[model samples]
Target: MKQLIIITFFLMSSVVLVAQPTFDLGIKAGINNSKVTFRASEYNSESIVKAHFGAFGRLGWGRIYVQPEAYFSSKGGEVFEEGTPSERAGRFDYNNIDIPVLLGVKVINGGMANVRVMAGPVFSVMTSNKIDGNDLLNKQYYEDNYFGYQYGIGVDVSNFFIDARMEHGGELYKHPTLDIDGKNQTFMITVGFKIL
Candidate 1:
């Protein structure tokens, strides 16, 4: 009788483990509010709002998961100086491809709803950059690539998800002659649907 009970327990545990969900793939798109901040510049900056769209894949084991995403993003800002007739000092336009690999933990699991917190480093490859209607790519004013980080919270409901995140990028480019040092900062909101 004891042997039969032990056998039954093992069978049920194995079935439960096999039934757990482990992987998901999704597409996401959202709005991005971004800005470029100068470390030593005469002008103040303003936020540049744009849109970002991407696809992501997630792998999970128990309550922990790792997610990787690829996205096209637009980021830049406008500069303003004091005592200027025009409030606009100059405008920066940057387009890039970004990848973020995140590590996350599910903090709350409520059947149909789950709350998660995630953070990770990001790598951005620049596609183009312009300053005041001039091309900065050929001038070598900024680096072609940058390193950054993103952290935020997310909610998963049924097959849909919503996330809000903040990102800060490291120095993007360098202009020794012009004495320019700038970084990227952004706040983003995204919605996603699981397709696979």
Candidate 2:
């Protein structure tokens, strides 16, 4: 009976070791070009370049994985008058804390490199805002919290990884007395190194 128990224990340990899941945690920083679009056609919007820094973690079982990330992002856009090239209308600038939970799949799983695709929902909370050239627009016009979606592709080479993604945010601003509303669209690229 003692010999039988010892053999069973070794078998279980081997199974557990062979089926271990993969996990990695890392820090990342990236740049983004962001813009705000209005529902009204009379207002024209332009993109702005900004920076973001964050930490991310990934857990994987075979080719499927979940990644959760939190980052501080600076985003905004400038408004222009329709049909006017040089006339500056106004600008909206804000900082946000963004959190995204992504589901991803490895399309090409190689020994040293991999290609992946991912999509997920993101939640953002405004930390600060600045409205320029317009007295009618203030901090009150913007929502404190909002939701968005992100989709992207990524490549991993050894311990280094890179990702390119697009984000579309829900309604960010709505005027109290006017029919003006705005949302955010952004393109971002990031590079990171895995610590574990």
- Candidate with maximal TM-score: 2
What is the TM-score of each predicted model, taking all chains together?
A: 0.83, 0.87
Model 1 Cα lDDT, one tens digit per residue, 38-117: 77656567897888898999998677899999999988877655455454467777888999999999999775799999
The alpha-carbon RMSD values of the candidates against the true structure, listed in the order shown, are: 4.4, 5.0
Deviation in Å, model 2, residue 112 alpha carbon: 1.9
**Which ten-residue region of model 2 has the weakest summed lDDT?**
80-89
Q: What is candidate 2's lDDT per residue for 1-196, written digit by digit as tens?
A: 9999999999988787558979999999999899999888878889999999989999987788999999999999988767766445677899999999999999999958999999999999999999887553566889999999999999999999999999999989988777768998999999998998
- Could you tell me which residue pairs clash in candidate 1? 142-173, 143-173
Model 1 Cα displacement at 152 (Å)?
A: 0.5
What's the true lDDT of residue 41 in model 1?
Answer: 55
lDDT of 1 at 172: 85
- Residue 100 CA displacement from its true place in model 1, Å: 0.3
